[model samples]
Target: MVADGIVSAYPVDPEDGPPVGISKDDALTLKALMSPVKGALGYSLEDARQLYLKERIGVGEDPRRHAARNRLAKLFVRAEAGGLPASTLLVDLTRQQARDVRDHMLTYEKPGGGKVAPASVKRDLTIMKAMIGHAIREFDLIKAAHNPFEALEVGISSGGEEDIAARELKETLPDAVIAAMRGNLQGELNLIWGLGSRHARLSH
Candidate 1:
């Protein structure tokens, strides 16, 4: 029987003497340490995401890029509303659950309406993969263990085909129209426009 916050453990051999009493806190700590999940107690996905963003900021990353990454990171927390419970500790997250997150993003709908594009879904997953990977390395988790988000194939179509199709469908602007637009632009604006036009020409 148990009393207070102490648990009794008995040895198989009667010659080993009386049962040992362990406090619940010590027992929980032992369990957490022995569990294969890894990571420190109470460390969660949201915590990892915040740390990752801070690291990026420290490296001089742009605010806009940080905002974009934050949006992607929030999807994991939002997933809890869908019953995924992504706010749990990294150690508790399984490969199947990671795949489920990918599926959720694939089927996610936009605020204005319509489903998210597959390309965008791929990008989101890629960003998440990086974030999780960063957490795993930064936390100094089990060296032999692989990250749950690693090598998940987003399976997006090749960009080459899309680019070719876009180019084929685009209507070329006439020289007169280009001349008129360029003429209305100011000094710096005209230089920027010229550079943009040159880059576009070079791309083709």
Candidate 2:
């Protein structure tokens, strides 16, 4: 029976040495046992996050990277504690789940009883989205896929916008104009540049 086959897949002890050189029939039985449950669609979020952390640490770290890893770890720990199973698959994530997490991040009190900051919630959501995207790409977990994070509307304002703005400026603004916009521009100059950017977008 399939149950018996799956049960047989478990090893007995280290003293017995590793299981190897099994018969082709036994190999097939083992593969069937190890396969994901029916309807299981993607890698677990816990596994994916760990993979992301592993890759980041592989490149070594400076202060900023270390801080980022710590922040992300805190989020994952919080998520698991909030009843999100470590076994929950990334592809199973919905907008409702994303919003649930966002709401928790925004309102949950710390061990000191202080509420989480809006900025911190925003930053963590940004990191969460990027982490999911990176994990999917790196592992080919999904094929020809729609990213759950792509459509997530985490109500925070600042998350991921810096990267978007940088890309937009690179594509739309000339090098000389970009250089000129640097440093402290007076209020008038700021308004002028903002209006000019809007105009450029409309013209394009």
Candidate 3:
């Protein structure tokens, strides 16, 4: 018999023997055949987060990247406190839940006072979307088309031309100011900054 694509393997009584008509080896074979399929859909968000971090560490990810992921996890924990529980299974995550998560993130306040910036909220959501996408792909859970986090908008802007222009604006010090700042710096710091500036110019 099969339910939800899972077949019922032949039963074996460990303390006794295989049931009625089945031999031990045949039961074993059935049991092996019916082993649970592993995938991200079977994991809770927190569990998947842990697995992702563990994998990154195993592959020697940079310390800063690990710290950033931990920060994101903490943010998710806070969101859980607000309503979006980390115990939510990936398979059960609905689009409404994803929106609720974004809403909670937008409501976060810095320790000093101000609400989190829209840009920061957008960035956090982007990272979260990427993480979930990676987990889905890594576990071969489902097609990329099925990712619930895909194409989620943080509602940061009205998509106005002015907003676009403001975002694209570049702020930089004048050449004279840069030279003055370099002159004020001492030894190795100055050397490093000079080399960096030269490389930046070369790249551009």
lDDT of 1: 0.64
Question: Candidate 3 lDDT, tens digit per residue, 1-204?
Answer: 432123234454667754546654454345445544422135567766777676753335678876776777776886586566776656657788777777677777768876766677677777667767767667666642245667887655322212133424666568999999899999999999899889867755
Off by over 4 Å in 1: 1-30, 33-42, 58-66, 82-86, 142-145, 156-204
Model 3 C-alpha lDDT versus the unseen true structure: 0.64
Which model, 1 or 2, shows the larger lDDT?
2
- Work out the TM-score per prediction: 0.54, 0.53, 0.53
Worst 10 residues of 2 by lDDT: 157-166
- Candidate 1 lDDT over 111-173, as tens digits, reads 887666666666666776777778767876556344677887665432322213347568768
lDDT of each: 0.64, 0.64, 0.64
Task: Residues 83-137, candidate 2: write the lDDT tens digits.
Answer: 5656676656666666677666666765776665565666777777888888778
Candidate 1, residue 188: Cα displacement in angstroms equals 43
Task: Give the residue spans of candidate 2 off by over 4 A.
Answer: 1-42, 57-61, 109-114, 144-146, 156-204
